[model samples]
Target: MQRGLRSFIIIWIGQFASLFGSALTRFAITVWIYQKTGSATALTTGGFFAMAPTFLLLPIGGALADRLDRKKVMIAADLTGGLCTVFMLSLYLNGNLQIWHIYLTNVILSAVEAFQYPAFTAATAMIVPKEHFARVSGMRDLAGNASRIFAPLLAGALLAILDLSQFMIIDLITLSIALLTLTMVAIPKPTQTEESKRAQANLLQDVTYGFKFIWKRPSLVILQSILLTLNFLYTMGNMLIPAMILSRTNNNELILGSVQAVMSAGALAGGLLISIWGGSKRKIKTVLMAQVLTAIVGRVWFGLGYDTLSWLLPSFFVFFFIPISNGSTAAIWLAKTPPDVQGRVFATRRFAAQFCLPLSALLAGPLAERVFEPAMMPGGALASLFGNVLHTGVGAGISLMMLLSGIIGAAVSLLVYVIPLVWRVDEILPDHIAEPSSLIPEKTVDSDVGVKAPEGAASPAD
Candidate 1:
């Protein structure tokens, strides 16, 4: 293997372990919270707390990533996250663990992630060659999908045999593994440009520079707008999947779990495929087409299917395309944005795309419970209108919601694709050229400042 890709694989192994451990802890805590309170609202409230801080703090985190050593920033984030787990363990051992303590810990960890994500993303661009951006992104998605597939099952099995405190120790161990891997690798840093030098002058400007960067580029603005709209619409329907399944299946957890497992498996397969194929040459087209397919095949089928097989098929298809679309999008930005400014640019892109998630979370339940549910009930106001197509019943309203989201999402993606700016993004935005390393000698390279590779070392693409 090439040296750069080899180094990245080592890091990926540690990160995969860490991600699995975190997923296990999160699942265990979610079960514990629900069992103790028996209130979905209380459980959801903790999630809101966890997400709120990350949204608010991401720009600041991005700024820090740019100004600091990316490696050190990641190490600090891992250490803080590990400490949060330890704090929770201590509380549980002392019999003082409350729902509030979990919420507090969630908030802290979310904040740490705000910093960690940007640094890691920026570092990946630094070390990997441009040709392999999509492949690496697919690999990252693979880790996440693998965690989703296994974490819940493993956590449940362990919980049956061990206490939550003991389970949490595993998380700490994973964090140490991540830290060790990070310490061993060297990440290249971007050579400073005039734009970066000016950005460094003011903290506030650094935070906002990402926004300005995108705004100046119409193609990027359109891309972000498309993603933002899709996220808002998708989240509105996506969050209701569990409710729809449970209600339709008469609260059968087995069917629900089976469907979820299939979905994760599909995503895992897609990620693995993309990692090998590296996506299509026209990444922008790949991204848009994937969304269209996801909406038409996945969401539309989900709303129409009533049986277990029906749900499983659509769920798998939806998740499978998601990784392809996401990997393509990451590759687009990685190539277009200069490495020195990627931390901020990428963070802003994420913040904009996901800004509506919490809003959708708030609205989806109320819309389903009050408006859609009532309207879809037999002989209800809108039942006669949509009844013939949707089959008015327990989850029929949510089915309608899903159907509508899919239609709208598909239409929006197509509409955006037709726009010249978005359709021709690749042609409009030129790729950033990598600076030659001859200017900075290997003997003088500093880890904090950044290193291009040691002399004679091969990069990922090579």
Candidate 2:
């Protein structure tokens, strides 16, 4: 392997390991909290605390990533965040653990992630060749899928065998491994630009610069809006999937697990495929195609599943398309944004992309209870139209909602694809062309900065 690619691999391995550990701890803590409180409101509150800090601190985190040594920033985030796990362990050991403690830990970890995400994302631009961006993104998604599959199973077993405190220790060990790998490899800094320099004078301006950058690009603005809308719809549909499954299967947990596993398998397959193939020359078109495929296969089939096979089959295809769309979109952003400014730009992207998710979460349950469920009940308004096909039952309303969400998602994808601004985003937005080393300018170097490889470490084109 090329030197830069080798380093990227090492970093990826460390992160993959650390993510599994973190996921296990997260699952354990969530289970612990729910068991202790037995209140959905408490659970929701914990989730809110966990996610809210990301929005609040993302811009500031992005600024730090741009201004500081990215590797050191990651190390610091890991160290501090791991300390929170240690604290939780101490609390659990002493029998003083409370729901509030878990909530606090979630918030603290979320704050740390605000710093970690931007730094890691920016660092990726430095290590991987532009041609490999989408592939690397697919690999990252694969790690996420692996973590989702691994963490819960491991956590469940560990919880039965040991305790939550022990799980926290595993997370700490993983963080240490990540820190070690970071120390062993150098992460290139983005070369300084005149604009980057001016923004450094005032952090607030740097933050605003991210917003301004996206706002000035109409194509990017349209793309961001599309993602935001999709996220909102996805969240709404997700909120009701469990209910649908339970109602259809007569509350069979085994069937629920099997269906979810099938979904993950589909995503795993997609990630593997994308990693090998990268994507089409027109990344935006690839993304749009994936989105349309997901809407039709995931939503429509998910809504129409009247039996186990039907649900399992369609959901596999649904998840199968997710990584293709997501990875391609990530590659487009990575290519368009200058590495130096990626931390800020990506933070802005994440912030805008996720802003509507909370609203969807808050409204989904109430809408199901007051409107959709009632409307789809036997002899209700929507029953005459959709009930016969979907059946009149507890989950009939959610099924209709899923069908509508799919139709809307497909319609939106088609609409966006036809819109010249979104359809031609890649062409309209110029790619950031600079040597990776130059992006990591000397001005940002410090004692902890990673050592660069020899000049010949990269291929000629790189």
lDDT for each residue of candidate 1 in 312-430, tens digit (9 for 90 to 100)? 77877767787788888889898888889888987887787776666766677778878898899999888999898878887788888888888998999889756999989988889
Which predicted model would earn the best lDDT?
A: 1
The predictions' CA RMSDs to the true structure, in order, are 5.3, 5.8
Tens digits of per-residue lDDT for model 2 on 108-134? 977887887777777777776888888
Superposed by TM-score, candidate 2 places the C-alpha of residue 87 at a distance from the truth, in angstroms, of: 3.5
Candidate 2, overall lDDT?
0.72
TM-score of 2: 0.85
lDDT of 1: 0.74
Candidate 2 Cα deviation (angstroms), residue 350? 1.6
Evaluated at residue 76, the lDDT of candidate 1 is 74
Please, what is the whole-model Cα lDDT of each candidate in the order they appear?
Answer: 0.74, 0.72
Listed in order, each prediction's TM-score against the native is 0.88, 0.85
